[model samples]
Target: MKRIRFVLITLSMLLLAGCGLQNTPEFQPTLQDQISLYCLDHEGNLEMREESGRLQGYCVFTDGSECAEADFFNGVCKAGEIFGEASKRGEIGVLSADEAVEVEVNSGSVDADSGSDEIVLE
Candidate 1:
């Protein structure tokens, strides 16, 4: 029964994913297409100034329900566990929102300079 529910929800999220996946902040060797790594306890924040000029806001991850909203100068990234089925069912409390965020620890940059041939998004 549990497996069936997981499969159904997985299918739903897949169908809803259109193309906004390149902005995930999980800090992996290689980024996943539509899946961002969700952290359980370790939380973080970042003030990113993208060269593309399309991300400026806050990225927060706390207890559950992480979100990322970038603007023109700096952007934010976060990840956390979610309780209910619908992702939009909760509020952004601890990870509410911030503009002056900064990246203290990042795993994504470790992947940026590595050889493209040895890179794989697992």
Candidate 2:
């Protein structure tokens, strides 16, 4: 009886050991993960949530400013530089002078006081 119990215990231990030997693949970080990591390293706050069966990430700076990273819109902060509005395919692109000028011109056209507080009835 003692020998039979020893054999059973040894087999159980071997089975448990074999369970840990799974051929699981290593985790690979996605683009959103990479962006979130970059933001985290740049003194920014990270927020992650699931929406519509998809994961989304957002990064907010210390000065109450948030950056956007999405399709056709890429915003990342690296080495004290802000990169904005471009395609993000695992690469960061610098904004050019002409694009900056265009953005400035477009932004200048919007005036906070342009809208009248009182509506005029005809």
Candidate 3:
């Protein structure tokens, strides 16, 4: 019947549209955006500097007696100890290696404070 054919065509169109949506790429936020949101949520702040083509930085949570610091290079912290505070805070959970790379990339954006030769996270 004509009605049956129309209904089948409509359902087919709907199914094709749904399949197209599933294949569409979703937007992914940059690592810096995530860090900024986390800092805002946790009352934390970050300071960083680039020296001799290396990035050094730290993050502190004002409301908690916890902090993290590292000298990042080649997608990993030089000393492998940057996430101590992150682990203690426990909200962000464990960071993967890729996230660590993101952190290093984010640090590349900071300008060194004037006349400050060294930044101590402690």
Candidate 4:
């Protein structure tokens, strides 16, 4: 009887130990961690969110436009566009001048009697 009780107790303890091991904490990265990793791997600033253990967000431009939607799972960006219209705009200049030119324009006078609001550019 003593040996049977000892064996049963030992088996129960072993089963409990196995259960504890199964419940060990998993190394799941948070939204910020995923974003940091994404930024390091990719270019530009990206905003991220975590949903059902997956990270999702959009790469935003300086003008506050949605460049692309990024979806990351297990710390990997599975789908998204890195650069969009904003990046293209950055590459292309709006105005190009061969040489610097000086021009003067009226900045509006504070006093009606005095015309001293003229701004001179050099």
Best by TM-score: 2
Q: Model 3 segments beyond 4 Å from truth?
A: 1-28, 63-66, 69-122
lDDT of 3 by residue, 1-122 (tens): 99999999999999999888756577898766565455445455666667569764455545333233322322233222335544534534545433554432323232376664333332
RMSD of each: 23.2, 10.2, 15.2, 13.6
Worst 10 residues of 4 by lDDT: 72-81
Steric clash count of candidate 4: 0
Arrange candidates, best TM-score first: 2, 4, 3, 1
Pairwise TM-score winner, candidates 2 and 3: 2
The alpha-carbon lDDT assigned to residue 44 of candidate 4 equals 44
lDDT of 4 by residue, 1-122 (tens): 99999999999999999888766698999876775566446544677667559766655544433333333223222223233333433542222223344546646335545665333333
Over 4 Å off, model 1: 1-46, 62-66, 70-122
Query: Whose lDDT is higher: candidate 1's or candidate 3's?
Result: 3
Number of backbone-clashing residue pairs for each candidate, in the order shown = 11, 0, 0, 0
Candidate with maximal lDDT: 2
Looking at model 2, the pairs that clash are none
TM-score per candidate: 0.17, 0.37, 0.27, 0.31
Write the number of the candidate with greater TM-score, choosing between 1 and 4: 4
